[model samples]
Target chain A: MDIFGVPIQALMGQLMLGIVNGSFYAVLSLGLAIIFGVLKIVNFAHGAFFMLGAFTAFLLGQHLGANYWVALVAAPIAVALFGMLFEWLFLRRLYGLDPIYGLLLTFSLVLVLEGGFRVAFGSSGQPYATPEALRGTINLGFMVLPIYRGFVILAAVLTCLVTWYVIERTSVGARLRAATERAELTQAFGINVPLLVTLTYGVGVGLAAFAGVLAAPIFHVNPSMGSSLVIIIFAVVVIGGLGSIMGAIVTGLGLGVVEGFTRVFYSEFSSTIVFLVMVLVLLIRPAGLFGREES
Target chain B: MHLRSLTLPLSIVAVLALLAIPFFPQWIYLVFVMKTLCFVLFACAFNLLLGHTGILSFGHAAFFGSGAYIAGHLVKNYGVPFELGILAGGLVAALLGAVIGALAIRRSGIYLAMITLAMSQLVYFFYLQAPFTGAEDGLQRVPRGTFLGVIDLRNDTALYYVVLGIVAVGLWVVWRTVNSPFGQVLRAIREHEPRAISLGYPVARYKILVFTLSAGLSGIAGALKAIIFQLAALYDVHWHTSGDVILMTLLGGMNTVFGPAVGAAIVAALNHYLDPFGAWVTVITGVVFMACVLAFRQGVVGELGRLLKLRRPSRPEQTADQPARGESQP
Candidate 1:
């Protein structure tokens, strides 16, 4: 299984790492795309929400004695509820203003949430042990793989597929898309557009939280954990073309692998490489890979 | 006419009074205040691009951090005078801004922001790996040296005066730039790009030029800061610095001349006061941002300016609705 003098074992190891990272990237970007498409806001607080989700899981586990599965499901829901509250209380007012206001507001929200978390939990990374059920590794013929990594990859893919199916194929998805495209007309059809908007925001933020829960065992939960990843996700969203779910999912996964490979070859440039790709993508296709042309 | 003639002298007096801060018992507090003032210049410079030019930059810290690094290196290794070190930092940042801005301005909106962010991250990595920057340890123990070869900037009084002088000059330049015909064109572009383009303005070139100027000014602030603090660390170049500047500008009022300064002062003071709260600083910053955007959109200074009716006279009213005023298309 060796190629180019690199061991198959090492290659498989990096590949597994790439896939796991890709899972998080895919899920997070999917949420971003959904929110952007419907709300027309970049939702800069998305990363903060993700951080909160992980922390929620940690808190619930520690205090409520909640098991991993329960925390996994409940954390995102809790985050979604918070997201709904935010939309209702703050974001709904800014829909008429420039998109910059939305970006600014969400940016502020990120600061507050991240700051609050840091103050409460301290600045250091908190460790979350992997659940017993998903512990250990599986020995494939060519290479060994972590069971948790495989689970993350599988779960992330399932989430993406379900989201895509719901948004693209179902009647509810049709209503959602219509509401975004023409809120007034959707209202004329007797559908509650405001509720739909709130629900969409919740669902989008919830996805970010879900990814956070999945990421807890792999990445240490920390106050500043989300800050580093948020910028990269922004690049991903831009390259994929904001508001395009498929584009977000595809670009997120693909860029994660590209980043992983860059780490293998040029360790120093790994962080900047994604941004470089974004620049190149913008140069070649201003509207993004899957973004519709702005009228 | 009386008010017009008194403006410069009044501002000078104000500047001198600010310079007198170190005479007080709270000299240590003056250092902290001066540092915040430096960030005000950074944020205001950034707002020239983001607020007036309507181009959100995600990589502005490249200029700022690079300037700090260059200044730190010059003071530490080359033994250059403090003024020269700051000047060299500004020049380096200007050069970088010209190159990066040229490439980035080819795209619009989100693409532009992403490209700048990437370019800055690239520079951040470069600084991290570059030998002179000291990588992880950063450049430290930088000498403050003498100001203009006479006054010792190492002394708190001298440093406070130097910082005040720099802040006054930077603010004057920003005010002048925003009020000039060139600045009006920029505002036009921000409010309506198509109209500005149709009016025969080279929109992209103007944007890039202003961006370069702003970046260079911000570099001056960052470089001066490194000299004052006697250190240039990796944290200065990180995206968070860029975010901090954005927060400052947004919190203070984006387009107003004094907004970034006021915002910087408040944020810096809060940072110092809230040191006990640790990581919660981010949460507080986020809350402020949310509150500002949700309600205080005009920002602290901008809102104040509006309240006081101190906004610069409207360009349209001054020009008598003529299309051919100044450099207007024939």
Candidate 2:
């Protein structure tokens, strides 16, 4: 029953929790990587958009009596549509400028979204209950785990794989890659690069929303939820390297485990350790763990 | 051309407005304005590095919060005079900045931002664990010691004047620095680092120096704020505070001297008025930021400057005798 002076069950449970956290991290960071790959802009509002997705789910479930399953699908799509509008209406104009401006623009968007949400919902977090189907627990050899958490992890992994496949394997993915590398040439080929750009933004934002919906049950839905988590995600993005999807996934999972271990060993440092790793990674491999060197 | 000379008059008018704040019936309003002014100074200091030097620091709250902690400790423990406490707090921040800036200048762009962020996080952790920071409770119930051993700072009127004077002095220093030759070098480095370096200018040194100066000034603002509030909480050192300052800078107009002040004032006032709206304050703030970035890129003061044509004179407009130096010192 005991392992390394800790209960095997407790350790296994914590690991399960860690994996769940990692799943969210992977999904969110993947979205960021996709956007940065093409736009070269660090989307500071990625977390806000994610929060919007959760809130959208909350509202939909409240007003339309939509089930959790319905929200899980619709929230991301809705957020993606909104994101496309933002890209078309605003971010399109900032393509050729310094990436800092893009960062600033997104930072501002965060303020707008977060402030607006706070006004609407108040500061207190609202709970979104897990569906009855997921209310039970599964007993394993060493530990008991929540069925809902397992579902979240499975859903996240499936999402990540589908995103990876779409971006890396499909003809559409080829075009998106082409647009990222050479927009003018892609446009010259009559590929509608502008439209692709907008879609990319939407997809990136949509992914964030999906993560938000997934997270709503675990973490209470709140306006300020995005602010705390986004910074860590940013660090993850940095450690993983911008524009590297695999990097994001690997780093997200790895850091989540590291964070879990830290919590067990040194609780005080659980939060700051991620940033410390980021600093070390930057010094050791400035381009990031998986990023290609900029020419 | 004659309007250029109005800078002095405009500054004086602004000072007068601040001086007359006590005449208002709402004591809370005066305190609010004082808070805004402190933030304005903080934002302006932030701009020295961000707007002029082209380095966006995400960890500026380290200096700001550290300054607050030092001031709080001095008043609560050592019983130091207000002026000395504030001065000591700024000095401490400057010292810390010297070290942080030295390490940070090695990187550029996003990397620099990350490094500052990491450093600030380190400081935040230190404060969280350190005994002097009072842990989670924070250094609370700080005394409003006498200003220069003369004016009683416990009085709201007295505190208001002290804050006003500090803001004025801080603004003046920023203005003077921006116009000075050293400031020009900092700008040059921002606009074109390689070109400035090629001209035999030590670009790194200039950047680090400016960063330290900015940190020190921000510390002063934070210290004054701690004295005014009689408390130094964990929130001061949080990365969110850094983001708030950045918001103030962007909203007001990063490049202009008074823009951050105006932005800070507006945001502080918004917080007061929007308190009734509850959580929507964050949503509104986010919306405003998004709108500003998408539509009002020039920011409030920047737009005003453009509309009024209060632009600073170009290098060419300056006396033609001083040719702009090239990177390579011939």
Candidate 3:
């Protein structure tokens, strides 16, 4: 009934929580991996965009009296458009230069967004209630799972699968891959590579915002929330390897579960275990689990 | 218009300004200058890797914060002399840097930065949970401790001079490292790692050495900060501090010797003046970051050098042939 002196029920509960956390990690890092692949710049503002999504949802609910479903549908689209504007205006200029500048530019956006949110709202977190329909818990025989948490997992998985399918299967996806491999050559083939790049950034940021909406009800919606999570997601990106979409999802979920197990055994180290995994992965397989070794 | 011609005059002016600080109108200004000096050293150490070596380690605060913790514990609890405490902090940070750099140097560019950031997060978690760090409260009321056997650092004037002296020595080390043949090898590695390897240089080894040295020097700065404030708090090790150092380096002209120090002063002054504005400081700082990256990529000192038609002090040929080469808005 117990695994290592902890009860099965408790273990199952933690596992459920871990999967929920993993879902967010998957969605967020998937966005990161996609952005890196096409744009060739790590979007440091990805986390801030995630926070913006949550805030957008909150603001809509407050001012527009929008429901959960409505906010979810609208927030990402709005944030994505903003992201596209950012890409077209600023990020476009940094291409062909050192990638560090891209990172630096996006990082500044983080400061602005987080600071702006903090000033407009207080530094403390704002609470978002779970939707009316998904307020109750379901019994999984072994453990009781919150309906909202289950919904979150389902929604996140669906989003990831759809994104993966679009990027890896469709003809549009072919153009994307071609552009990523050889931008100039792809353009020579008569594609609007610049537009495609801008769209990719928008989609990537939109994905982050989508994850943010999902997280708003579960975690406190606050300015500093994404800053901390972004670092862990960076660990996830590293462990999974950069630019690998499948790798980002799998590693994120696996690390979440691993972190959950660590909590059961060594609760103090739950926050640090992912980083430890990163260090180990770097030692054994420097290219990352899913990444190709750079020339 | 040669930068070398201005170096002597600039150095003399800077020294005079530093010495005159103690005689400033207000006593509170000393605290500001001391803090700025600490950041100046921290930013310079950071530049050794970023500006000179072309390696971006985003998690640099791990070494800095650990150094503070180590030095603070030694001085406050173990009764070690301040000198030994500071050295111990630097050595420990160097060890940490070696371990991190050895793993991180395996990957180049963006990946390297992520690895360092992740490792520093791990370090941050440790400090957050560790008993010795006093959790969030930090190691407070740490004794200033006497310098040597008798200098009496308890006096604010005495402590300021000691801080200034140590920071000067630290800056000299950075200068020596950059001007030495070893520094040339670092530049070669930075410009092109593959070429450096083809030329039979141990590229990874050199990267690790610079990383270790940078971390050690940063540790000295952090240790000195702990002594000056008489406390070792969590923010010193936070990623925000790491980001601040990067900003200072970039805004001051990473390639120039004294650019980061000037950048540090500007940032410190901003923080001091903007203390009344609450969250606006973060917004302003962010604006500054954007402005620097977008328009002023060459930084304050680098821009000055360009305006005067003075060749870049470190490498005149690179500047003349390709102005703002990597940083140009292409």
Candidate 4:
């Protein structure tokens, strides 16, 4: 029952926890990659939208008596709509300028969202109850896993696959790819590249909201939660290669597991392991693990 | 046309006006001015990288906070002179800058920003876990120790003058650096990196050097702040501080030499006045950020410079580079 002088159950538990975290990373980074690909703007407000998703769910539950399932379906849609509006009104002007302006604009949005939420709800975290059906524990041969966590892993993986499917297989996805590659040409071909770009931004942030709702029960729902998570996701994107969709998903999951194991062995470094990995990756491969060199 | 001839007298008047701040107790608080001076130095140093070198480093808080923590730890525990502690802080931060800068400059634009941010997060985690930093409570009640073994800094008036002098010297260094021949090369690199590289300039080395100088100056600001407040806290190292510095530089006009100083004062004043609003301060700051990015990219000073026709119409870009760079002769 011991592996390398540590309990097998403890390792297994960390592994499961890591996988759940990986799922969130995978989903979040996928969104980042999508936005960066199509808009050529780094959506700094991605994390803000994530927080918005959780807050929307929390408020819906409180005011409208919406259930967990209702929130899971509605929060992302609402956030995506909000994101599309942001794209239409503000983010559109930033296109073709230095991407840093986009980052600064979104960073400002983060301040607004996080600060506003802190005002409405104190900085202290508010908890959301795990759904009744997924409240129990599951026993595996090596470890006992919380049913909610298992559900999280399952749900997150399914979300990633469906997102991948939509982006990779659909005709809409082909148009998106075409726009990302040659926006001017795509427009010449009668594709509304502008609308596609806006929708892509919406979809990207919607994915972040999806991860946020998924995280609500596992982590305390708080204003500042997504701020830090988004930074880590930025690292994940960097390590995986910016704008590389497959790279984002794979590196996110891999780094999460690496972080989980680091906790088991060198617990003090748990918070910093991903960043350290990023530093190492940059040193070895400046273009990132999956990114192509820019001309 | 004679505006450039007035630069010397204007600067002297400004300094003398600053010297008079300690005397005016009712109108302007000494502590507020001291804090603003710290940010002025900090923001100006940040612009060395941002405005001059065209590198957007998101991890500047690392240098600032580390400087604070290092100086605080040395002065409190080891009983080092305040000057030595400050120097040590700058040296350590510069060293950190060199390492971080070398790694970061390999990538440009957004990747560079993300790398610095991640590294700073790593530093943040270190401070959070390190025993010396006191985590949330921070390194508190640090002594304001003597300056060069004289000048009792425990007195607010004495400390204010010292802070003012140090900030003046710091700003002068920034001004000198920006106007130096080295600075022209930096501008050249910022304007076009590939061209600079092809022109035989060691682009990466220049970048790392500028990053080091900026970090070192920023470290001095952070260390002075710790000495002034007699505390080094977590917020100094937080990413929000990084964001705050960026806002200050951008809003003040990164291209203008005196812009960040003006920007820092304005932002510090905003924070001072908005403290009572609780979280609305952040909302307002964000609104300002949006406005600045969208409508005021030229910034307050930049717009003013434009309106004043600070430089010849033939050299539009140089207008912001140095408003007083020997262009006064008719």
Q: Write model 1 residue lDDT over B292-313, tens digit each, in one string.
A: 8788876775555444333344
Q: Would candidate 2 be rated incorrect, acceptable, medium or high by CAPRI criteria?
A: acceptable
Interface RMSD of 1: 2.2
Query: Which segments of model 1 are wrong by more than 4 Å?
Result: B1-13, B26-28, B309-330
**Clashes (candidate 1):** 12
Identify the CAPRI category of the predicted complex in candidate 1: medium
lDDT (10s digit) by residue, model 4, range A138-169: 78988999999999888888888888888899
Candidate 4 residue spans exceeding 4 A from truth: B1-9, B310-330
> Cα miss at A217, model 1 (Å)?
1.1
lDDT of 3 by residue, B158-198 (tens): 99999999999999999888888898898888888889999
Give per-residue CA lDDT, model 2, range A1-295, as digits (tens). 7767777777777778788888888998999999988887878889899899999999999999998999999999999999898778777788786677788778767777777777677778999989878989988867888999999999988998898889899999999999889989999999988788888999999999999999999999998888767888887876887767777888888888888777776778887888888778866877778877654
Per-residue lDDT of candidate 1, residues A65-181 (tens digit): 998899999999999999999999989999977777787778778777877776677788999989999999999978998899999999999999999999999999999999888
As a whole number from 0 to 100, the lDDT of residue B52 in candidate 1 is 72
TM-score top scorer:
3
What overall lDDT goes with each candidate model?
Answer: 0.82, 0.82, 0.89, 0.88
| Candidate 2 lDDT, B82-128, residue by residue in tens | 89899988999999898888777766776577678767877888899
TM-score of chain A, every prediction, order shown: 0.98, 0.97, 0.99, 0.98
Judging by lDDT against the true structure, name the best candidate.
Answer: 3
